[model samples]
Target: MPRAKDLDTVAPDDFLNSTLKSPLPPRPIKKPQNKKIKHLHQSSNGKSHSAQFRQNVYGILGKTKHPFSSFLVKPKVFNFRERDTDEEIILVLRRHWITNLTWILITLSMIIAPILLTTVPLLESFPPAYQFISIIFWYLITFIYSFEQLLSWYFNVYIITDERVIDIDFNNLLSKNFSEAKISMIQDVTSTIIGVSQTFFNFGNIQIQTAAEVPEITFEKVPNPEIIIKVLGQLRQEEELENIEGRVK
Candidate 1:
């Protein structure tokens, strides 16, 4: 070996020439991935939107998904008389359309039975006076069946407001059941979707446990019970925040 100093030290010109001849590798060019990400985000958002209101509970009444608008006795204004000025109706829910099938079948049978009876030999044997009376009785029964079933369905509703949740049940022409609980009083929520029809139609029941007088409130056969549970949770969180900020209304 020559001098150690000579071996260890290279000329500045040689080092400069080596770097100039062999340049450092270029950094990998990144392709634009924004389009792919944007497309995915949009599709996810669309799916969520469509799933939220997939089926309308008021299909018999109208095309409207909203219960308030579908009602024949809908108010011109949103604010119902007894509700506070600040209270707003977040949602008005009715039992799923599947639940009304029983009443609908009964009404249809009541309507068709009269026509079927007329063709029977037993009705033909009756006197004119008796036949007329029979026809009147048949029609009266039909009317009552139709009226009662329709009235019960139309009046029975679950109202969720900013302040509370109300369950209005119409038992008959003269009797009704009403239950309500404040939003803040709600403690837990459970949703159940049992039966093939319920699973297929995406309708279910929501059971809410509360700290109020009524410990538990069940919303039976309601459409989109999972979404309702999510909404109740969000509403409770909001109510809690409002209370903390002293903005309770």
Candidate 2:
């Protein structure tokens, strides 16, 4: 009986030991924890850093629509004058009618003189060679007149602005004279409509006296000299007002 009792005790102990040696419930097969990912973008202030960056970029780029108004540095009070809201101004030119008439008269003479000389009974007795030479001369004169007309039209330009005046004088399309004077430096302005032709045609010359090194500025053969003078006087008055108000620079 003692031996059987001891054997039963041993078997129970071996079973308990084998059970303990066996793996425990696989420890719930714990998986490695995934690391949390951090975002690269973050706010500097309460506002988004990206939004602030875009705002800065916009200010640097400036307004695209109104180029004239953008990024203008305000002038000092003493230097300030009437500002030119419009950078460019009315640019007048010599009337096309005057040039056309001059060319037309020359062309008509060239055409009519030769025909009259050839067709007239008194001139028909002239030598054929003389007539041919005369015809060629007349055509040559016509060509010269046409060339001059083209050159005059091509090179004539006048520019007027609140800030300054520009006169581009081109003689024969090859030699050119460009003169400019500031509106503020203008001391005296004169307009002359001398002859009956000038008065009838409403065109004349305007002379401007300046304080600059160049003593005088003349606008020759400009249409409506009186109107130009008036416009200039108005601009000068505005400039004076602005100077008094400390708005011009």
Candidate 3:
């Protein structure tokens, strides 16, 4: 037999028998993955772009997605003045962007008309200063029109909460009509998608018949009308269940 010193220098494989199996490599320790939530939770104290607004929520609403989205599920930043402390907002909706195309096209035409015409035939008769003022006034009016249209789109909203349905008609900065009805009061919900654009964009009108002070609430040119109806239906069912349980008590 070889000396112990010689055996130690030899490769382990040279003396290996089947019984001396190599210890299995330690099992890899996997790093845990963090799963992201798709919707905002009220308790999470979410925030939006506005500093005053503490409702911030984002779900794949990246560069490709509009920040002022037409549809948001479990929105965290929206809280109407009348919102109850415990009321949880389920959805926030604005009119589909396609609805603004007509005004946007008009605005674009107005912007380019002066550039294309170079000089207005009417302005030719006026002094240079007067002509400049006229041009400025035209551009100012164009800006106002576009700004108003954007503000209307941004402020006007339809909201769905656990307990109620809300509609806000933001007519202007200072003037808005706020309307709401309890989810329990909803009697019927109907959705209508009309026109090629509406159909293609999957946006339409939602007509809600309710027993509240406002008999009917219509969401015009809103995206995902069918989904809104379905959500309402589910809420109605939940409300009915709660009523039944309350009656039993």
Candidate 4:
């Protein structure tokens, strides 16, 4: 081999020129992607304009899902009366079936009696006027039954709300009386189911003694008066506890 120093003689200028002359590999060109812009419209104008454009957008874009943005505004507090702890109130109503029973029986009687009387040969021998009067009487009886039932359903209705007890008495369609008492006033509750008829029928009366002007409130011919009395008692106890706590507070 020739002398090492002579064989490796290289110029920096020539090396640089060779490197600069070499072609670079082609680069991939990336295309720009179109994106949708969301804008909120001014509430007064009901239209929104994009920052990049002057055209008004008809509808809201990306509006907040919650309409009540209360965080952006001051919160408000409302004042209301709190319930007394020593009072428990409940709603009571006559059983639907019991209330409707009189109507059902009357209707059955009206239908059966007329048919039985008119179909009998001897009864049919009565004058046409008598038959007409009998028919009228039957209709009258049915009307009376209907009227009574409607009156009872309307007036005899009792509602026990948390705050008070309400008694409604409808003597006729035209006559009505309403009474109410606070649960705190309730002193005594009595339930009575008298006779085999009432026991079998599951109907009875509930009597309430109160501290109010009205000494006693009686709910007549109500269903499951015992259960109602028990519930009322429990409510009364709860109310008493609440009252004691309230006094302490």
Candidate 5:
């Protein structure tokens, strides 16, 4: 008999015996998907409700979610900082969408009225130079009106932070009113939702009475007034507790 070959030197068999089995194939590893990345992908379609929801919660400043925007819509961060180290924005509030309806409609009318005026025979009676000047004047007026309305809305903001609540009022481009109340100074929080639109839209005003110099801070036409009241109450309680603990320490 030939000497037995070493086990390692045996020829590999393509077909195994009926009683034998090949080793199981290695298991595949799975990758964890990031929620933010998945949200961005979903937003590509622009119809994802969940993506919009996430944007509202996470802030509108793209990946950083900083809550500030160049556009006048849902600004998450006002870029206003009360404290550098510990200040964290809990919510940024703006007037309800319905509140802008008047200005938006007026803007539309301003845009459309000029075009409509061109159809009038009165415009045809004017000289070419006069007509051109008139058009320019109308457009300039429209621009000024639109700019003023947008600035009013854009600058009017209410911000709630861990330490304080702020109300910024823009009377005009040159005039601004800023008020703040510390969380510890909050004495009473209440909200009012009146009118069919306010009720239907689920938005109203939040009135915060505080022990601060301002005494009263009102966040007008803000969305979800009840929620704001609840959050304010909770924050006030937390602040009081912190003050007590600090005194003890």
Candidate 6:
């Protein structure tokens, strides 16, 4: 805008002629094309970084999935009998799969026991019917033992949820022992990987000391004991923080 002194210096006729003409068409702004291209590239790079970060997070969350896995994290299709609706399971574990080797070896031996025994004259002294019945009985016993062990290994599970720690054990087909302790009650966690096999397989036992009815709960031969301990520690911290917040209110 012209200042008062500059306007006073201009001729009235010139000022009138300038205002009277159709206002010059406003000049179109010239955008810097290179700056726009650079801005677009930066935005694309940010989006890619954000997408990669989300993918990594999902990979961490869905770390385990195999149904027979001894150690699982954030399982998608598992639920327990006594679990609360709001409680979320963070970890599900059983004895390391390698622990089943003892029974597996024994079962394999039992399967071939009859063949090995054929080299002996033990059945020669008996009648044909007696020998048949005896062999049948031996195999029956072996089958029963194998079945029982399979059930035991499959059913005995230790679970860690956002709210509690649970141990489920089946001593027999008809009997199950269920033990649980709140995350808030857990005081200390101790892990032991004693023998060569345990160390080699990276599996061990973990003892949890809690203020719940069961003072100490032990998970025998579970995989990733240190990771379990770390998760428990995190849960305990969260529980304590929640308690403090509750008390403040």
Residue 26 lDDT in model 4?
94
Tens-place lDDT digits, model 6, residues 1-249 = 754547668877778887988587889999767988887876676556545533443354458858788887777887889988877788889999998999999999999998888778876888989888988999999999999999899889998887789999889988899999988889889999998999999999899999999999999999988778777776666566556544211
- Candidate 3 per-residue lDDT over residues 1-249, each given as its tens digit: 663547558656656742367666799999665443423332132222222221221222212234488887776566788888877787788999888999999999999977766665865777889867877998999999999999999889998887889999998888899999888999999999888988999999999999999999999899877767777876676666657544211
**After aligning candidate 4 to the native by TM-score, how far in Å is the CA of 126 from where it should be?**
7.3
Model 1 lDDT tens row, 1-249: 542336358677767777899979999999887998987876676545433422221232233435443222223344444577766676677777777788888878877887888888977888989988877998898888778877877778887776898888889978788788999999999999998999998888888899999898888888877767767776676677667645566
lDDT of 6: 0.82
After superposition on all C-alphas, the RMSD of every candidate to the true structure, in Å, is 15.6, 19.8, 18.6, 23.7, 17.6, 11.5
Q: State which candidate, 1 or 3, has the greater lDDT.
A: 3
Per-candidate local distance difference test: 0.72, 0.61, 0.76, 0.58, 0.70, 0.82
**Among these predicted structures, which one has the highest TM-score?**
6
lDDT of 2 at 46: 20
lDDT of 5 at 14: 21
Better of 4 and 5 by lDDT: 5
Off by over 4 Å in 5: 1-77, 81-84, 247-249
Residue 197, model 1: lDDT of 95
Comparison by lDDT, 4 against 6, better one: 6
Ranking by lDDT: 6, 3, 1, 5, 2, 4
What is the Cα-based TM-score of model 1?
Answer: 0.68
| RMSD value for candidate 2 | 19.8
TM-score of model 4 (CA atoms): 0.53
Scored by lDDT, model 5 comes in at 0.70
TM-score of each: 0.68, 0.54, 0.71, 0.53, 0.67, 0.72
